[model samples]
Target: MFSPDALIASAKRTISLEQDAISSLLARIDDSFVRACELILNCKGRVVVVGMGKSGHIAHKIAATLASTGTPAFFVHPAEASHGDMGMITADDVVLALSNSGTTNEIVTLLPLIKRLGLTLISMTGNPDSTLANAAQVNLDTQVSKEACPLNLAPTSSTTVTLVLGDALAIALLEARGFTPEDFAFSHPGGALGRRLLLKVEHVMHSGDELPAVTRDASLRATLLEMTQKGLGMTLILAPDRTLAGIFTDGDLRRALDKGIDVREANIAELMTHGGKTARPEMLAAEALKIMEDHKISSLPVVNENNQAIGALNMHDLLRAGVM
Candidate 1:
């Protein structure tokens, strides 16, 4: 009953059919697409996407994509709109309704109310001649010759085409609005991209008494104590003026041991890297990570313009802060 070859053959056929359906959508991206974009761009209120069943799932995704990419949007189930939920929509909103048949009764019921409010309607339907398309100000034809389903009934290729078209619309508006990565990060502050863009070195670096430091005249044993107390595996060697004179790391301790130098007696200045690579207080934690990576070092001193050591951080600090 478990025939691998038959399963592979069926999967390939389904993929090929879906590929063909998606390719056909390219020719349909014409003036109607531009009008749809223009209508949404000019709208004063948010985009309200509505659909039913499988189409409702795709409508929800499209709304999320539009909202995160600079356009304000949300999804409202068509069936719910018939109830008191219709009040959620306003005269300023633009309605984007999706239905492959363009005749889903729940959606059709809202058309009258949408028209009464004089709201702009955009439709995504397989049948452009259907009632829903005829009522729309602009119709995005998502017609597919056949479904990936062998029975040609389940929505497969058509939903993919609609989703891709929605992504195209969102990205076009994002570009038109000159949306930046910072703008996107603001929308996704809890995500990794937000951590990379919004997290500053000062936000994660150790400062004040937490900063591990010792004078250049200190012994290697004293530096080791400072490193252990700070738990950064390194310490800053400062000059008399509290300016950064050098940095000493675990690697330097290893090299000192190789040279048969006694940690209790050897001057830290002899083993510390003089005026080593540094970061700024306002620098991005991601940028600080880059600097550590480029120099192949694990620790960095946060210095001011006058070369005064203000703070310090290590790879673990970045890792703890989610910058790594």
Candidate 2:
């Protein structure tokens, strides 16, 4: 059996090796890297990434990062390309090939066809002098001095370096293209970030008949009934002209009871909070959430410029909408 101390030491050694490999890449971001970015930025067609074995897995991830970060890219297996997928390549597209030794047979076999199609080629390889690197218009060198594996044969440090380099390239291009959070949200509409950025108060708030409101002169008992009917734990107190006068919540009821006021006879205007925090219909749900959190409140009344309550939303609505 392996000793605990030995396993910990081995893990630490692997981490140190990979960390050093990543640090070395900082010095290699030179003119070649700039040229590669220029080529991909100017390409009229999507980036077609191809690799074999372990490199292929990294290539797939790189392609996804590129696509989500404003660059159109997809991965194609080198072996599949040789069989029939080569047809996916167009003259307008750019090819990004990956190989550690820069001599992946499956990829090398497609060189002639790539050249014949006159497509611009970019390669990420460990060997600058290898065939794949030499054939590219620009090459990103991801050479690592040694593998993190004790045997020095596994694709450990090398793969990590390649992944970091790919992320660097994607981020550089994203900045060059002036990618924004809204642009990113478009690509990730189903994710939490997207929900926070894209969902507005109008999309999740209870509006129209769903709004709980009562005239300011109404009894605390009537306000309670409206709150229960709307199921928002609160109700808006409106003026005769429909403008907001105040708000009543469960907390207000507790305070009233503490003051020895009878619920059936107490006036809502005296017990309610005067025009508490409000949200707008077009406001982002995230912004509304911030308001609720900052005030330590659980509900918000959506009001227009004239202070008319048009809608209402509680923490539960945001939770159900995945905006919380």
How much lDDT does each candidate structure score?
0.94, 0.94
lDDT string for model 1 (29-95, tens) is 9999999999999999999999999999999999999999999999999998998898999999999
Q: Determine which window of 10 residues in candidate 2 has minimal summed lDDT.
A: 262-271
Candidate 2, residue 193: Cα displacement in angstroms equals 1.6
Question: Candidate 2, residues 9-108: lDDT per residue as tens digits?
Answer: 9899999999999999999999999999999999999999998889999999999999999999999999999889999889999999999999999999
**True-structure lDDT of candidate 1:** 0.94
For candidate 1, what is the total of clashing residue pairs?
Answer: 0
User: What is residue 88's positional error in candidate 1, in angstroms?
Assistant: 1.9
Model 1 / residue 15 / CA error / Å: 1.0
